[model samples]
Target: MNKSVLDASALLAYLNEEPGAEAVEKSLAAGSAIGTVNWAEVLSKAMEAGIAPETLAAELEKRGILGNTLDVLPLTIEDSMEIARLRPLTRP
Candidate 1:
């Protein structure tokens, strides 16, 4: 199975029963999971929308999702430096 990297938008669609929810579900059924950064973003959005953190956590656990199992790629020091360097450049 090809692994898919789901960004925050995709996860939000799944959680909110949006149009692409089915696709997201299908991906998960095929063994595709989310990265930690995306997971955190999804949880943050859910919390902002009034979904209790514990409830979300329990639901994810019930769905056989494990945070530690995600292929969370870490940001290297150079990557961090680049982001910092580019922040001012992209500022409006």
Candidate 2:
């Protein structure tokens, strides 16, 4: 199975039940991962939304999202380089 690498936007969509959330959920169900940087983005967004980081994490854990559904991946040097390479294409 091809594991999906979820960005902060994707995970945020799923968490907030926003548009495209189903797609994100599908990715999660089929084995997806978020890099540490993206995970931090999610946490930052949560804090901005007035949701305590621990509270949000606990809620995710209760729903079996943290471990069962989504995996957090640490970035390696190669991964950083790849992201940097893709940055230009991803940005206008």
Q: Which candidate leads in TM-score? A: 2
Most lDDT-accurate candidate? 2
Per-residue CA lDDT of model 1 for 1-92, tens digit only, reads 43776777986898789989898777666666565667788788878989986888778777675453334455668867896999999888
Which pairs of residues collide in candidate 2? none
After TM-score superposition, the amount by which residue 12's alpha carbon in candidate 1 deviates from its true location, in angstroms, is: 1.0
Q: What would the TM-scores of all predictions be?
A: 0.65, 0.87
Q: Which stretches of candidate 1 lie over 4 Å from their true place?
A: 67-92
Clashing pairs in 1: none
lDDT against true structure, model 1: 0.71
